[model samples]
Target: MSDAQRICLGAIAGAFGVKGELRLKSFTSEPEDIAAYGPLESEDGALSFEITLTGQSGKGALIARLSGVNTKEQADALRGVRLYADRGRLPALPDDEFYHADLIGLEVFDTGGAPLGRVKAVLNHGAGDLLEIHAPGMTASVLMPFTREAVPTVDLTSGRIVADPPEGLF
Candidate 1:
């Protein structure tokens, strides 16, 4: 399926044990919910797997077994493979919340309405989410905190974001 129709839920970190279990790093809010959306597809949509979560590993990663994997070699071969679920299978979000995928590519503008840039990516480095904005004639992208104060408005229907970033942030 196309990326627009699917949302990435997690990725295979590596083989977990000799019995074919895999280490999975979930991107879901509740990490374990990664497996609740039913079977997941590979990034290219060429492979599908039914995840059976076995336990949790270090750093909050999960231990899981794929439907057909039964050997360390089989699981190792799939390491680093990202897993995606159909968007329709996911629950709708409450207002004021948005999927990172939806935020990317949205135009960002300053409070005064001058164009700042387009969102290059949404990233979280533990503290909170940040919007990576890429603009013209800039040597590097600007990272703006994704907060109620920093970003006052996000109109998904209009594909725009109105940001009142801290002084000198632009």
Candidate 2:
């Protein structure tokens, strides 16, 4: 399936125990909700599995079992494997909210309509989301806060963002 049709919901952190249980880091608003999206597929769509949440790890990650995964070695092999759910299976967000997948690749512009860059990624480091922008002719990308003041508008239909970055942050 195309990436635009899927939404990455979690990743396997490695084997949780000697069993086939996996340490899953969920990217959903409610961690447990990751399992509610039906079967998930790998990034390349090479593999697909239905997840069963068995428990929660000490670190708050979900402990899950994939349909065919058995034994620690099997789970270990899936370490770092990202899980993607079909976009249609996910709950729709309010107009102000967006899935990170939808934000990536969107064109960014200044309030005056000057082109800034395209969104390279959306990231969060325990604080809030930041939009990584890849501007033309720049060796390094810029990280702009994804806040109301910094990003005044996100037009999904137009595939564009209107950023009002903080002082000196282009």
Q: lDDT of each model, Cα atoms only?
A: 0.92, 0.93
The runs of at least 3 residues in candidate 1 whose Cα sits more than 4 Å from the true structure, single-residue gaps closed, are: none
Candidate 2: C-alpha lDDT: 0.93
Task: Give per-residue CA lDDT, model 2, range 23-69, as digits (tens).
Answer: 99999999999889889988988999899999998997899999999
Q: For candidate 2, which ten residues in a row score worst on lDDT?
A: 161-170
Candidate 2 clashes between residue pairs 3 or more apart in a chain or in different chains: none
C-alpha displacement of 3 in model 2, angstroms? Answer: 1.3
For this target, which candidate reaches the highest TM-score against the unseen true structure?
2
lDDT of 2 at 143: 96
User: What digit string (tens of lDDT, one per residue) describes model 1 on residues 40-145?
Assistant: 9998888999999999987678999999999999999999999998999999998899888889999999989999999999988779999999987898999999
